[model samples]
Target: MKGQSRRRVLQAGAFAAVSGAAAGMTGGRATAAASATRPTSIPSARKSGGALPFLEGAFTPATKELTAFDLDVTGKIPRDLDGRYLRTGPNALGLEDPRAHHWMLGDGMVHGVRLRAGRAEWYRNRWVRSSQVAEKLRETYPGSAPADDFACNTHIIGYKGRILALQEGGPLPYELDGNLSTLRPYDFRSTLKSSFTAHTKYDPAADELHAVTYYPTWDHVRHLVMDHTGRLARTHRIPVADAPMMHDFALTGKYVVIVDVPLTFDEQAAQAGALVPYEWNHHHPMRLGVMPRTGGTVRWFAIDPVYFSHTLNAYDDGNRIVVEYTSMPAPFYAAGLGSGGPTATGAPTLDRWTIDLTRSHVTATRLDDLPQEFPRINEHLTTRRHRYGYTASAAEMWRAYETVDGQIPDTKFTNCLVKHDMLRSTRQVRRFPAGAGASEPVFVPRRGARDEDDGYVLSYVNDPDRGATDLVILAAQDFTGHALARVHLPGRVPLGFHGSWVHDA
Candidate 1:
């Protein structure tokens, strides 16, 4: 923000060499050939003021793919628990300046652990092969390759029969094996053309995967619909007007909710070699567009300024659509990344935004003042009226961040997991010990779960001081109680973006 090219932090001195080698490469190529590429680290390409906070400490990248068998468990694992827990983060490959680095601009690495019959089987980590990565991997590059490359970092999910790692505004998705190895290209059977978002929703009734995606070349954001069998169903271009970075969206029983925040892609910034191409442009004007699930007329509603990527849940509550999220004064750009940003908005506070369908107006009310984020709920309750909501403490979310200046400011990473009872407006919190941090809570329904809260909340707990990471599983109904099980891993896992559970049949 200090100079005309604030984003040059990504290009200029830091990325000049790396980007030069990467050349025209961007996003990533998720092909079978990429799987053969090896991961190499750059001796240089580090930040001056102590490698951006994310590339250090808990956010440090792990080199080897250590395989641990029969992990030590602190508590009894539920007999019904069966699946692999996988998460992804921007674990940068090598050779770049840390000074111009943005936390979200690194290559993708996925950390995964498997469980079966109440036993912890194994743990593994793999990096998604982006176009920038092949040069680091392929000692001898492939002669020809696909043009659509991807970062495949931000998020991962198990859809239909595939375990796909995804990133917003990139190639389709990267397919990973059950062991978290063998990364390959995925495009819903060659159905996708350009891009997809990090967050995609499923409609059990219709067995359809839905997402509103944005690409640099597209003038409008388009909705992607895939059938239950993982086949592309339809693609409809929505006229949101300008190209805004739309991270996550919500689904009502009949309508899809899209939030057009201030973050937008800048061609000039990108051409300048800024790794993180998007910048906040208030001129874009923030708005929520409500359109039918099948794609038709959109009822647009204007709202106050807030940049929240993840929404807990949204449903058709009578004639009003109630959407819940951790709304902040501004996006994380204010917290760190650079200076002269809107003053730190404080923690992202949980709030409920009610959209009146008939009147086309939005009414918002604060649900809780305690900053919390990554709101999740049981999949069965999505798009329908229900009660339970889960999240991590907002303080712990950005604990490793630093302002443009070289100062270790006090930051709060969600050190606790919380459950929000929407109907009653009450909350239950399960806090970790001092100096410990938690990951986003992924809700897993019990074998015969009857009630909305009848499930287990799963998250990774990292204790850097002790040098260890544990997958902590908590009974949803009794959140504050001891974890049902804490599957401990061999080493510390860098703080990451997101993950999901792939339940075994």
Candidate 2:
């Protein structure tokens, strides 16, 4: 049955490849655009945050699901690579009215590509059967075994043996099978009772997952710890000044850092019928609370107002803690504000915050002026300082990929990947062609790797020119030159959030 499913996916791809009408049907351009002029400005939605243009263009959800087997390999796939690369993003199953949309409110879908023994095994995309997706499919919201608030659209990972599909402000996770099939809601076997993060840090040394979870509807942020066995080991409340939508948090050797930014759930925005109710509240105090891993008192330090979707890494520096992330100069927009534009300039600079434990203050520094986001690092050196960080190049650097309907796309997009060297303050980048867009670069340490960065960095690139996707592998030692391998997919995979490389062993 799995083989049949894979064959079906490949057949669909072959049809799309050979059919001349597929360009119009799938929104693939007959020829690459001569130029792309995506606007940088957005509007403020007074009411009914309608029709985020970002969602329509490059972010459009597919009309059908697919499963393709034995994808073609363009280069030699290292035999050492043995795993599934799974990425999650909003893939709307149905949007009755495009005007009533937020980029974050779309239905959830996951795309997976497996590789083993130097073979591009298979490719599959599955929509998480959330209430919204279930309704679109005319199916019930599955069994009532373990209820959850699961968008399941942001990130996916393998925890112990369970593949957890995650979202922010959602307490429970939906577990998926090795083939990207949804199982059911998993709340640590119903031991958890609070919202969790899409970004959970797994400590390589401790062999535990640590998360500073926050519920948008609640006031307190909680620190959660799960053992290597995938059991909920501990949970404690981390005091916070406000209940901001904590998309991602920071991890250090001894602490879990919680950021309280200006993006808050707005009652007025909700009453105004905005699909995404969070807004930038300039008056709200921007602070960082450092809580011990053992769950003690939280030390709060006020900092300049800022917003960021991801952090590269954090580490302890004597009495001071250095946290590195990508932050912009203004209050970042939560969603496209009714097409007028986002809340601030979307450009992101590599920002560093040094939190002084003894002085009770934070020294803010702008390490790099480049526009970058989705900063990632070698996960093995997550808590401790490593030399390199990786990020998706901001959309402004690339021509926007057209959507199926060719409607919208003037928002955040990625076309290149970057690697930052912390010690020398240097950066190396790999820029995809004009019509190619890249996702977040996830670093996987090579088997029996010795150095912190002795590994490979992997990501998916959607090349509009080819109307397909590629799983590109880059040698960590070489930074970014040419891809070590490019496993070509038969169909397009939309831009997505976080993903994980699940080892088969």
Candidate 3:
């Protein structure tokens, strides 16, 4: 089964199950009616006396979408660089319950900086107008209606001459122009019938985009492949016991790595009023599935229970598959996204999992002990052996804070960017100033680059002292050396998820 037929069957089954679950959870009342009275964010049970951590400081939501011209630059901007650094994140208009707000729930706002000929051309931000946001703005909804009215606020990428703001689970992607203006909800020309994933690995060999997508209402996940022409080429549904939250996946030359961790959607929690209703389940079996890219039954391997939100890269090495990611040893967001900090149990670390095909065994190893997240690598080496990997320091951003005198004083913390020399078993770190934080480091290969690290690492660093943000560029080969350039912006670009350097075509 493929295309619309397969989608209809899956949607029918999912709707039935969702209806039954909602009825059971809400005593047969209409789901919409039940949801009307409940909080729009998370439950109030975990509400604190002060503002939520995600809504304060650098994570604060931007009030209006603005465009600035001719950004200030501290150092020489690379002449070869000509593109836009675009990122999307949750920026709420207004919360129904501020104390119960989850960090992950909000309207999507995209921030972008355009670079051309050694000059910072412009910096602009625009909200991806969902139905709710459109109504609030008194404008008609753009494009098609999205699934469940959820905003695409996780990652933004340029695919086939189109800028797409993406998020996992259920919702379709919101297409945007180069200026970061929302065009419409894009569904690959109406071919993507189920859902779209935020993280899609581009297979340079096949000239395709590979993704593992899951919907909260479905009990299975789909491995989707889009051909070089940006049309759906293949779809394979893989079943699981519970509806797991498969945020990201790994891609190798031969296999698509499926991480079926214990984090699952909870209907009860959703009915009881949790905006982001996924919770970690200890009873759920933690396993990994290796499925052939060509299509076949998945080979499942049981593993220790651990959650990883992002994967650096994976490759087929002889008879084994090597995977590296930022691993969270304990369950996270059990209550809600903003209920607790990510470092409650411990800071996440860069870890590796080696799966042996012949022995049908898996081994886990810690590559670096330092806390890190949002691992990235050179796109040219994706799905192949790579010498260098980059990550942002995760030590300070999500640290827990205590309320004092009905206020949670902002805690000053510093972060850094790391470069790992995988083959040499060494690493280099570049620490930021106190009260400063950096987003994910995006590697952009230099024009006509030769070596693997012959490129630049770009990140949006927020400086609390200046109350502004800067697009910091560093020579990837230099590792910890001085920055190549710092494009200063007028305001803070909130800490966001994955982004990419969309080169001019």
How close is every model to the real structure, measured as TM-score? 0.87, 0.85, 0.87
- The lDDT for every candidate, in the order shown, is 0.68, 0.67, 0.72
Which 10-residue span in candidate 3 carries the lowest summed lDDT? 16-25
The TM-score obtained by model 3 is 0.87
Residue 261 CA displacement from its true place in model 3, Å: 0.5
Residue pairs that clash (backbone atoms under 3 angstroms), model 3: none
Could you say which candidate leads in lDDT?
Answer: 3
Off by over 4 Å in 3: 1-48, 337-344, 400-413
Which regions of candidate 1 fall more than 4 Å away from where they truly are?
Answer: 1-47, 138-144, 331-344, 394-396, 401-404, 408-414
Q: When superposed on Cα atoms, how far off is each prediction in RMSD?
A: 7.1, 9.5, 9.5
- lDDT-superior candidate, 2 or 3: 3
Decoy 2 TM-score against native: 0.85
Candidate 3 has an lDDT of 0.72
